[model samples]
Target: MPRDRPAPDLPEPLAPLIDAHTHLDACGATDAASVAAIVDRAEKVGVGRVVTVADDLAAARFAVDAANWDPRVYAATAIHPTRANVLDDATKAEIELLAGDPRTVAVGETGLDYYWPGKLEGCATVEEQVEGFRWHIDLAKRLRKPLMIHNREADHDLLAVLIDEGAPETVIFHCFSSDANMALACVEAGYVLSFSGTVSFRNARDLHEAAKLVPDDQLIVETDAPYLTPHPFRGAPNEPYCLPYTVRSLAHTRGQDPVELAEASTATARRVYRI
Candidate 1:
């Protein structure tokens, strides 16, 4: 079935911000020109830079190239947990080479996604995901880069494995969707939480509460673009230019100033990604 994706429009601009995680490859960016065009749109709406994340080998390659192609772009690479079934010697070796790229800021978009294993065909089983997650964790640690994690309905296992593997110096839970307890646990353990558009949904009360509790410095913002478009714009085709919607929404949820949150989040992203 075709998605009834709308022609998404960027909202009123705010102070400049960085989209901590997004997928430029999925947002119609195929080369330097396309990447520049997408980024130009974002720059008009307060999004100064973006970290294009990869969920597979092809995306991994593109992400690195996009980072090099555009000064305002950075990259994070890893095979997504749902597709971890493809991990092998060749895959790992290439990913390592990509991770070493000065433009590649993190080793991830990887972790467990128990939500899809049974329902989705070709999804990696729990065992395979575990091995892949551990390998990515090690890669991040070795590279001295932050680990960007993608977790869905596997909070307990995700936290456990991070403990078991001796987590990298810096860890980020991208699109953090867990509740207050999980939020507190992450805060207590010194892991950063990057919120997305879902935090803007009114019914996500637990997530709202979680957002309120995160320390200002420990919280960052993302679009997870080409996905998780914010309310009033939900179901629309998302891109980095749409990030202001999520940013202002998160600031409202946390009772903070949107401009301040934007500045702080951008600083946190810069420090974490070192871009």
Candidate 2:
């Protein structure tokens, strides 16, 4: 594992904001006290609400527990598409139960990841991923919550499957990694795009364009913590407190004020997740 870099200093604060998607467990926020401390730091910087997402049963449970631990925290549960091969009936039942929790606001961090499988052994097959994704979509619709998606090198299939299966009332492309065209298509479909630290990298020109393409109401921001730490702090440990950096970068890309963008994202998140 890559050793986390020294934690970065706080960025300039924004008005109270929301991390639409994050991973507190992966960020080493394991217990109530730790989760509280993390949220405290975020609150200091105006990130007042956070939705921690899960990739599997263990993480899903942790997300729910974290939410119950703090009112500022909420949860989104699912078997990540990369782990789709493991979505057995028992696991599905457990996720279904968790999805029904009032604090569980969405049915993902689930979708397709074609980046790792064929090049690496022991990855879930495309067929397995598709099966799991469809199941998750159903859960989102049944539960009347937004569907939070994780699309990596599988944009075409992700959009196709969502359209074919009929998307839930709300859909969020978390850490959206597609180009301008895909962003336009998703916008046309009324899906919200949640950008992450990747948007801050100078090399992410296409993502910058996509960020610009997304209307203020359709845009959101996240840390995707413990990964995708923003530029100048790349490879550093990321947490919700670090979100303002990405928000500022996103605001720059969209030619909007940071505070304005922050307000829009927070409102959009609350609306989509029904928080």
Candidate 3:
């Protein structure tokens, strides 16, 4: 069955903002020209910068290359939790080298995902996932870069491991998906919570509450592009330009002016990624 996808379009231009987490490669942008075209579209709508994250070695290599190709792009590299079993020595060595690049700003999009494979859709056992998560955590610490985490149905375990292993100084829970209590816990622990388009969904009442509690400096916004497209276009193919929709929705949820929130979120992103 062919699922109908919403046509991508420009939302109203917003104050220039940053997409803290997205995947340019997954968005059908694999070459420098294609990446630039996508980025240009984003800039026209006030999305001035983007962080393209990779979930596997192949994607990580492309992410680094894309970042090098465009000044407005930066990369985050790591093996995704579900692919934990594949994180052998050779792969880690390559990722380590990539993480050292100035264009690669973070080590992540890696964490626990109990929802996958066993619960929904994913691979690797819990043990394998934990091993990969710990390795990535260490990579971020040693590289002195922010740790970008992707948690899905394993928030408790994710937080526990970060705590047990001593989280890096800068940690970002990208596309945060948990309850308000977890949000508060992350804030209290000095971790940044990045909200994605999912926050805008009417059914995500708990997510709405969580967004409201994230402090100004600790809160950031993202499109998580090519997935989690914001409401009104929930099933659409997302691009950085679609960020305004999510930002506007987040602003409404936070009860702050949209421009104000955009500026603050952009600033927070820069501070975290150091780009």
Model 2 weakest lDDT span, ten residues long: 1-10
lDDT of 3 by residue, 1-275 (tens): 11268556888899779999999998889799999999999999999999999999999999999999999999999999999889888999999999999999999889998877676455988899999999999999999999999898998899899999999999999999799999999999999999999999999999999999998899888888888888888767888899999999999998999999999999999899997
For candidate 1, lDDT tens digit of each residue in 1-275? Answer: 11467756777887679999999989888989999999999999889899999999999999999999999999999999999999989999999999899999999999999999999989999999999999999999999999999999999999999999999989999999999999999999999999999999989999999999988778889989888888877777888898888888899888899999999998888888877
Off by over 4 Å in 1: 1-5
Tell me each candidate's RMSD, in Å, in order.
1.2, 1.0, 1.6
Which pairs clash in model 1? none
Which has the better TM-score: candidate 2, or candidate 3?
A: 2
- What lDDT does each candidate get? 0.92, 0.91, 0.91
- The local distance difference test score of model 2 is 0.91
lDDT of 2 by residue, 159-185 (tens): 899989999989999999889999999
Off by over 4 Å in 2: 1-4
| C-alpha RMSD (angstroms) for model 3 | 1.6
- Per-residue error for 113 in candidate 3, Å, reads 0.2
